[model samples]
Target chain A: MHELSIALSIVEGAGEEAARRGGKVSVVHLRLGQLSGVVKDALLFSYDLACEGTLLEGSRLMIEEEPVVVFCPECAAERALASIQSFRCPVCGALTPDVVRGRELELVALELTYEQHAASATPATTD
Target chain B: MNNTPHPPRLPRLIEVRKNVLKRNDLLARKLRDRFRAASVFVASLVSSPGAGKTAFLEKTLTALRAQCRVAALVGDLATDNDAARLARAEVPVRQITTGTVCHLEAEMVERALDGWNLDELDCLFIENVGNLVCPSSYDLGEEMRLVLMSVTEGEDKPLKYPTIFNTADVAIITKIDLAAAVEFDLKSARRNIQSVRPGMRVFELSAKTGEGMDEWLRLLQSRL
Candidate 1:
């Protein structure tokens, strides 16, 4: 899957972020969805290896697994789809009208050590 | 982030939740800006193995090279079969042998252009490793994304793998010459494509006979 490639990029970027923050990354959180077209296990398998010898070497991988959610008009119910291929609702067998979530590829934020001393800056202002 | 999980396992809940694909998206945007500055349009093609991707590229190179400065980078899990095939067409081609990898990433492309001059080319075609599922996820800094399916494949390819079709800007139907040989239903194929990507453009052409290639090239030229 493209997860390996994406994972490699993450390691590279996380390394950069750690350098910017003056601390090494300890964990990398990914928002993987059912429709991001990513295989979470494949990506997890590649992350540690990809992060080897990099700034994110010891970082852990965290994933927020997203459910396949779709809107059903016949039953007027928003149902969870078991498979990406499944479109019919289990409650009413109604065909899904559209997807509400579960298709996103985003890098929301990076969590760093937030060293309290790091926030200290030379104040320059005129009162 | 080192507080405590309501229910924690030994997997170490380190808050290293960083976006892994940010670099690729950044590099892709840089590449897009470069392409726009030079007015050179780029497109990546993805398909299953033995889907005539090389043949299609060879045909396309032959047709477009005379008019525009055309080049290509072909990726495979092994061997340089595709590069050799495309080289015979007398165009600049590079082979990227991705050892043990299933798809081509944007970084590989950045490395492949080390010697070559990107400014000299008008259109660069990247033929990704033959996999419909994997290549759909990575962006290769291309202005267009062409997901290909051959006539020999089932007509329901779009329905079967809607993600690829959804990611791709266009769908290319290869090996139209063999449509009759395989009893390919062209009508059903068009409908299937439309179902997945509403109002998406399509080009049905056989790289062998050059059938319907002009239209395909015309579309490419128009994009540029």
Candidate 2:
């Protein structure tokens, strides 16, 4: 599944972010879109495989699904779409051509422990 | 041994707003720059299986080769069937046999063109794996992306898979010669496409009969 590739990217990105923060990530927050073409369940499954040896190993993936928004020309307003199949505006029955959101695939934040903060604050000292 | 109470370890939150496909997107942008600098026009074709994408490409390569340097990279889950079928057009064709992957990514394309000289070719065509779903998310750095839907398929194909149509530059309705036999509703197809993507360019063609090949070829040439 393409979710594996997407999961790999997320893991790699989160690992980089975690390294910059000098901590081990415990959870990764993601914003998934309805039309992003990524399956959340599949991505969650692949995330474990991607983080086997990385900084995000055993980390939880928290996904927040984004809602679809369409621009209604008849009403001249943006309306939230319940589904992609039916583009008919909520306010009016006219179909809209513009889609403003619901295509997001973003990594929003990372949860870390105090041990990670300590790791970043000081480097190993050698005699 | 003495027991002592220890303070609680706090959990910290780090904010990072980054697209999960950023790496692929960055690579695609670089590839786009490279193609632009070389003056090579790149177009990618994507469609569901048995939609006649290979046949269409074969006809296109045969016609386009008469005027300019043309080559193709075809992707499939298995077998070199498509690449072999396209090679008969008498142009360079390579098959990226992705064992199980559903879609072709930018890295696969970049790797496929490793030693090829982009300046030598006036145009390059990448025929993606026959999948309407996963391919929509991966950008292969093509200047034009064509999504094909055959008349045999339901007219609501675009509505069902709007994401693919949303990401595509043009929509090609194939197997038009059998439209009447299949009772394909042309009006509904057009309306459905419009519903998903307004003002999208559409080409109705029959690769078997070459009915609308001339206009399609002319459009490609004009774009080049």
Q: What is the lDDT of residue B162 in candidate 1?
A: 74
| Cα lDDT of model 1 by residue, B1-224, tens digit | 34332232122223444445656667778877877787778999898898888899999899898899988999999999899999988989999999888888888887887787778889999999999888776778999999889999979888888777867888889999999999999999987786656557899999989999999989998876
lDDT score for residue A81 of model 1: 76
Can you write out model 2's per-residue Cα lDDT over B73-95, one digit (the tens) per residue? Answer: 99999999999899899999989
Query: What is the C-alpha lDDT profile of model 1 across A38-73, one tens digit per residue?
Result: 888888898888988876777787777887677778
* DockQ scores of all models, one per candidate: 0.19, 0.51
**Candidate 1 chain B lowest-lDDT run of ten:** B5-14
Task: Give the Cα error of residue B57 in candidate 1, in Å.
Answer: 1.0
Model 2 DockQ reads: 0.51
lDDT of 1: 0.78
Candidate 2 residue-wise lDDT, A1-127, digit = tens: 6898899889989988776766578999999988898889999998899989887888999999997888888999889987676677877878776888899999999997646335434332211
Q: Which pairs clash in model 1? A: A10-B20, A27-B16, A28-B16, A28-B17, A29-B16, A29-B17, A29-B18
Quick one: best TM-score, which candidate?
Answer: 2
- Measured by DockQ, the strongest candidate is 2
TM-scores for chain A over all candidates: 0.75, 0.89
